[model samples]
Target chain A: MMTDYRLTSLAKSLPDTVPFVGPETQERARSRLFDARLGANENVFGPSPTAVRAMAETQHWMYGDPESFELREALADHNGITPDMIVVGEGIDALLGYLVRIMVAPGDAVVTSDGAYPTFNYHVAGYGGVLHKVPYRYDDHEDAVALFKRAAKVDAKLVYLANPDNPMGTALSGAEIVEALEYLPDGTLLVLDEAYLECATQNIALPLPLDDPRVIRLRTFSKAYGLAGARVGYAMGAPGLIRAFEKVRNHFGMNRAAQAGALAALEDQTWLRSVQARIAASRNRIAEIARKNGLRTLPSHTNFVTIDCGSGPEFAKAVLNEIVARGVFIRMPFVAPQNRCIRISCGRPAQLDILTEVIPLALRAAELR
Target chain B: MMTDYRLTSLAKSLPDTVPFVGPETQERARSRLFDARLGANENVFGPSPTAVRAMAETQHWMYGDPESFELREALADHNGITPDMIVVGEGIDALLGYLVRIMVAPGDAVVTSDGAYPTFNYHVAGYGGVLHKVPYRYDDHEDAVALFKRAAKVDAKLVYLANPDNPMGTALSGAEIVEALEYLPDGTLLVLDEAYLECATQNIALPLPLDDPRVIRLRTFSKAYGLAGARVGYAMGAPGLIRAFEKVRNHFGMNRAAQAGALAALEDQTWLRSVQARIAASRNRIAEIARKNGLRTLPSHTNFVTIDCGSGPEFAKAVLNEIVARGVFIRMPFVAPQNRCIRISCGRPAQLDILTEVIPLALRAAELR
Candidate 1:
């Protein structure tokens, strides 16, 4: 029950579970440092040196351009869109929350994958929207058609899909996604989260028409650009829909340091390419380690790899605990079947080397226990 | 007129006007440099030098500690409260927005001053809350009892009051606030915005019980701490109420650089005191400027001064525009009577010198025009 302050029934009904815990929280709880910090899929390669330098240089300003004119212009130039067609925010997390606030309301129907990013769902719940979740495909890819069908059936106001899915490390082809769009019911907006887009295989570009009124594509500096802490992201859509963000967004919400860092990171595409190369190598090393330990590694098109532990939830939990106990921080999916797999992120050579050495010991410990 | 998205009827109806346009936006529009940036009430002295150094040192991390453990622990120690009772976020603006999101829903009643901070009103409108605005007292104090009476009449769910208030630079003693608390009707939450608390006189502190479930105090690093660009702030209230933020807050929204900077800024209280001294000096200088121009200046408890331009809104607007054209940026209150007074922030000696030199010239130009 809520206090006498009179919170809405929806807020009073929502549980207090956080979307994701940072590795720092885990370290604090464990009272020791993780030997391999590969959780939360953060790019351990670090942000571009130039971006870091720029943030450092501009640390004295009160606030950045409320319009985010410079960063928006740069993003538009990079994406071949008009500056007015974009809005910059703290991160895609914040943008997701705002989009829900702009669109969904009490009793409105929203659709998403069953085990998708919980933060988006949290926003929907906060707005009192009813969520209809579709299960992932048996092969682990997001079932785009199923999502569209669900949205149509519920007359959903919004439908969320993360291409190059998380937790399972699977992806839907751009063409596959476009084909599903035909099934999208009228007046249903589609949210295409492309957070891991840059790190995915080059063939996955759907290039949703910018003029399409029903689609908004979210891209961020957090993942491949390695600037999650800076919290900068953007969404592209028809100018009309995008402008609605102005009606409610905190005009000066964009931190000056974040805008400077993101601009520099975007310009240094060379660093991004290098990080991609390193991430690819780290993924392979993880898969090799899993194979050596007699586990089945799911084929991945993103920075992280998920390996089937060849056991039940209890066994997978045991294996994960053993690794974490051994000072290797990693995570697993929260849902059934998917929870039977362990997820590891791409990092530097030293981090992967530690993971390579620890997986076998963890497996053996789990078996013995 | 919302597109296919199902916005709350209230959200669909909210007006798009924000509190103020950022100085950066003005700079972009004018395509020229403002010699004096006295707008936005930002400290021209910037943040503590120590904060600048700290942010520069830690700009490359992926994400900060999600729990904000160290900062909260330090803040709790400083405030004589437990860390669990504090919730840190991007800034007081973000915190106010979050508080509104949790407490107010479509058609929910909320109350504030007619000419109070527009940002809070903007948040209320965005969430579809019905806003009940009480006019400012003739003496320029926020009429606390009148606000309570209005809230009671409307059965308001939340009421906002900023002590050492913005725009007016006036304050109510803690005793006064606590006394007003008694008039707050049952089921009403009081939002005590103490953004300028540290800089206020000794009389501002009231030994009110923190466990009184009716009130939540908002604090920030934006004003006296001079880290507005960093976007770090916190809310102090009963643990039960504070815990509710976990239900919908962006779990990883706090910036790593900002966290580090705020921690260092908190640690260097000696530097903070020095900034306070400088602010006091600047405030006096602003008053002198007003006096020399034959304008009446209010007694200010915050970092800015409200100078009555001895004219109507049109004259105030003319002087303001003339100052802007003369390359000194400042602002005025949005409503009548209050609009007769232009607000000027405390700045460095150089910035103050510019304001001193420009006020007379701008007034003369306005008179001639």
Candidate 2:
């Protein structure tokens, strides 16, 4: 039995658990380091030298401007949008928590693709919202139409779609999403998480109008920008919706060094391009290695490749455990069918080289099991 | 009429506002920079050289350990508690938001001193909690007895008390707080905000039992540690209450560089001592300057000194506005009596020199007004 201490009924009902355990926790439990640390999709190539310098030089004593003035100015300039349309926070995870709290009342319905980003669902649940999950399409892509249809059926106020979706590494075309957008009812908001859009060669990111109050788009510095530990993410929407964050969000969530790093990193498009090129090569190499191991790699527009283990969730999980046990960190999907695949991020050549050596051995171990 | 986007009943009921407008926002509005940055209680002496180096050398590519393993371990060791008794977050502001969310449901009762920290009240409002405010006693200090009595009477789920109280810059004795602890009801969790405790020369911080489920103490790197921009804060409490934070907190909310910098800052107590010495001398100089300007300075345990302008809130406002217009940044409290006092942070000698130059002129301007 737990001590309640008069915690809200919702909090009392929720389990004392976190959304995802970190690799460091796993490493501690295993008492070993991963030879190839690819899980969680952190960009191993790291941040731009300019950004690193910015972090060093940023005034660490003063609290960062809660307004995130300069960073927002740069982002607005780059996006050709006004600063009022942007609200930056610690990360997309933190923004999601804020958005969910502001939008979802107790028993309000929210829709998302089944086995999509679990963090969104985690937040939705924490706010006492009822969730409707639409299954992924046969190709393992998130079902855009189904999500919209479910939102309408449930009268959901919110829908979540992770572009170039996580785990599966599959994405819908921008046009495809625009078509589904017509089905969203009035007052429903689509939280489009484009965390990995930069890594994609194609700009599958929806060209949703900046003034469109129906959608909020999130971007992060953790992946292609290589500042995961800095925990910076921004949400862009209509001014009214973005401004709604002021009511509930932590005003000073932006870290000073992180903001400086993000500003410098934004200015270094050349470095971002280089990282994109490197990720493309790594993706190609990962696909090649998977082919050699007789595993089919899913077509991905994101930095990671999802290889079909050619069996079920258990087989893929065993393979994942084998890879992890051999000290190559990787993750797998949470649900059936897609769970038959294991996901690997765009590792550096050295880490990928280690991956190439161990994955086949892991497959052999999984087979033996 | 504004577009609602059908926000939650609670959110729709809430006024869209920020607790504090950042100085950068003011600078942008004025199209000018301040000569002195002494407001906001930030450590203008800046972070230690070792801390700056740590920020530079942090592993920016990786997500900070969600568990905050190294930082929490160091904090636990320093506090003579296990890591489980501590939970780190973006800042005390964020942890307060999360605590309010988890503890206070809609219509749940919470209590705090009327003119105490505004941010705590901000969070309580955002959560739709019914807040019962008790006015300060004649001493201008936060009335601990009044706060505890109000909490008991309201059957409050949460109570907030910031020692070395902000605005007034006065503090209570540890024994006095321990005496008030007797009035706290079983279901109420006392939220002890000790953000400025490290700056206090006296032992004003209560030696509350860490194992006591009735209270949680929050500390930050933003004040004496001079890492406000980093947004790193930790809450210490009974292991069970601390563990409860895992259910709702952003597990990876911490910035990588910030964590590294804080760890280094925690290790370098010599730097902390030097900063405290600087703050002490600065506080004394601020008091001396206020006396020379025909004002009285409150006895302060915090880094900032609140000067009684010997006038009402309007006169204090005039003085504050004149200082701001003259390119010197400082602030005044928002409530009466305390609002009669203008708060100035302990700036470096250069900044303090600017303050000394401006305060007399600002007072003259206030008199002219």
Candidate 3:
């Protein structure tokens, strides 16, 4: 497919397909805007008012702190770690790509679940890392033990697992992950992507020590904080591992407004709590809609629900297309068995109304197809 | 020095340095804020009120157009080129890093001036590209013919030259560049970093045809548009080279506010022209000040002026430090010959007032030292 100038063999082998289509892209393709954007797992409730005010206040400033010193200090105070333990980036997507650049040299083995976040896989493939994908468990939670075993078998340098996994909205317990670590080989770094950590149930194993040499935890203002547009994400790990980012990371990469907005977002716990409540209400409404349609909704600890549509990928695709045609944006899994389920993000009441009204129609349309 | 973890050999060899120390970092280090900031060539006039309003308007939107569809289309209309010929990134810094990643395999040759923007050199080093630096010719503008000769000598895959070159505030004509392109090797890519293009006095170059494969031009909203905090920079080249970015780019990398702000900024050429006029006035004022102090000012096509201190790097450093100590922030060239000059950004009348008040005192202080 690449014709003119030759890219590195690794880049040449990468597929043009991306993990998820942005709603704006879909809107352009459909030639009509979505009436309800409950796809892509974004919080439609939006960022905190305080975050917005902070961003507005800082728009006049020249480039935010390159070291992100103030934000890092505030985050350190909030997360109970020294500033050296964290490295902020454009987003988890950017941070993950940078990590792969550091750890996964050409031909290095990388491990993840078969139905895991495809963007992580895309990055590994982009960097010429050999991917070893283990299959998901019955509940759609990544099988951590299996991932570790595969990493050991392949002598992998990196393994990625997103807690409260995407597409399925399923999560593994901290004990289970800790148990699986026993099987992990030395020198392998575990990239625990907790993008939705805030929305998950309480006591879900957070505040991982900064000195943990083998584990790097990623968190973002994008999801539960309703700041997906800000593009602020941070990684926490041992100081040496974190500092390695300076070698290749864009020192001035962060947006000034994002730094201001994210710092304010982190400080506004009351607003976050309010969003959590709304998310809980929205999730329940989605579950009720699924039940009414004779579908089983997976118990979601995140900001979205995955409902078994009682069909295969073909039927799921039909339902998605039908809903999408009616200006209701939704998505589904990419692989077999999992593809039987469709995913919907938690939005406000108006968005839920659209889904509740359209689900039966979409299901009927799928059956007719 | 990297005790807890072993970085790749390439990362180890890369120096721990950045092109410039940002004002925010300096403020932290000094433990006292500067009264005036006229450094790093950022627009002190601030972004267009329209851009700020637009960003504030869209601050809550999750994920902008990943394709950057609307913005790209609008820019295409503005530039009289197809949208396929453009790719936007965090800033020109990130774009340079990405371009280097694609072109330079380990030990590949990359060419730039000895005293060119060090960030380009930093990117080349980080990517394990062997840097081939040609000295600046006696004339202030980059010697494109000499650069081409060096590129040919080293079989350089990439050649970087910032028109309206920084630190010296010099520029080459569009015709001179086009003439030099004839000598560019078939496989080599010319990275024409025109970060200050809008501020340059010369007749600016239009986006070349989509089939012009030998050169890729970089532009940013950070300069004349006064949106340095926005972190929006774009590259224009043949569609084939531009599309290759998808293979390794962080797909959802852009900030939504930045996308909205840059779109608004690009549309407001009236504001841009006003800024250009202000910058011109400030440059003239700076040159007059230099003459009054028996210093020589170079011909400037950019927003900043580099005044020769009629001494060496040490003397210039003293002057720069004195300026900083007296609450004005300015910089000088990092390498010799050029280091005999100090770079000062065009600021509002008040900022220039501080510079005018401080420079003489600073020079006297340096002489006494």
Which candidate comes out best when scored by TM-score?
A: 2
In candidate 2, clashing pairs total 0
Candidate 2, residues B281-338: lDDT per residue as tens digits?
9999999999999899999989999998887889989999998988988887558656
Q: Write the per-residue lDDT of candidate 3 for residues B227-332, one digit (tens) a residue.
A: 8888888998888888888877787989898899999988898988999999999999999888888899999989999899999888989998998999988888
Q: TM-score of each candidate?
A: 0.97, 0.98, 0.98
The runs of at least 3 residues in candidate 3 whose Cα sits more than 4 Å from the true structure, single-residue gaps closed, are A1-3, A206-208, B1-6, B59-61, B204-211
lDDT of 3 by residue, A1-369 (tens): 225564555566766666667888888887888999888888988888999999988855387678888889998999888999999999899999888887777888999988788889888888888999888887777899999999899988898888878867888888788888999888788899999888886646644565689889998999988888889999988888888888778888899999999999999999999999999899999999999899999888899999888878888888889988888988875587688888899989988988989999989998998
Task: For candidate 1, list the clashing residue pairs, or say none.
Answer: A90-A231, B90-B231
Once superposed on the true structure, which residue ranges of model 1 sit more than 4 Å away at CA? B1-6
Q: Residues A1-369, candidate 2, lDDT per residue (tens digit)? A: 237667788988888787788898999999887788898899988899999999988999998999899999999999999999999988899999999999998899999988889889889999899999999998899988889888999999999999989978888999999999888877788999999989887989787777688889999999999999999999998999998988888888899889999999999999999999999999999999999999899898888999999998889999999999999888885687678889998898898889989988999999999
Model 1 agreement with the true structure over A1-369: per-residue lDDT tens digits: 235557677788988777777788888888888887887788888889999999999845477777778889999999888987888888999999889988887889999998888889889998889999999888878899999999999999999998778878788888898999999998899998988989886668675776478788898999899998889989988877887788778777778888999999999999999999988888888888898888998888778999899988889999999999889878886587678888888878888788878888999999999
**lDDT head-to-head 1 vs 3, winner:** 1
> Lowest-lDDT window of 10 residues in candidate 3 chain A?
A1-10
Query: What TM-score is obtained for chain B in each of the predicted models?
Result: 0.96, 0.98, 0.96
Q: Model 3 shows how many backbone clashes?
A: 0
True contacts kept of each: 0.66, 0.87, 0.56
DockQ of each: 0.62, 0.74, 0.59
**Candidate 2 clashes between residue pairs 3 or more apart in a chain or in different chains:** none
Q: Top model by DockQ, which number?
A: 2
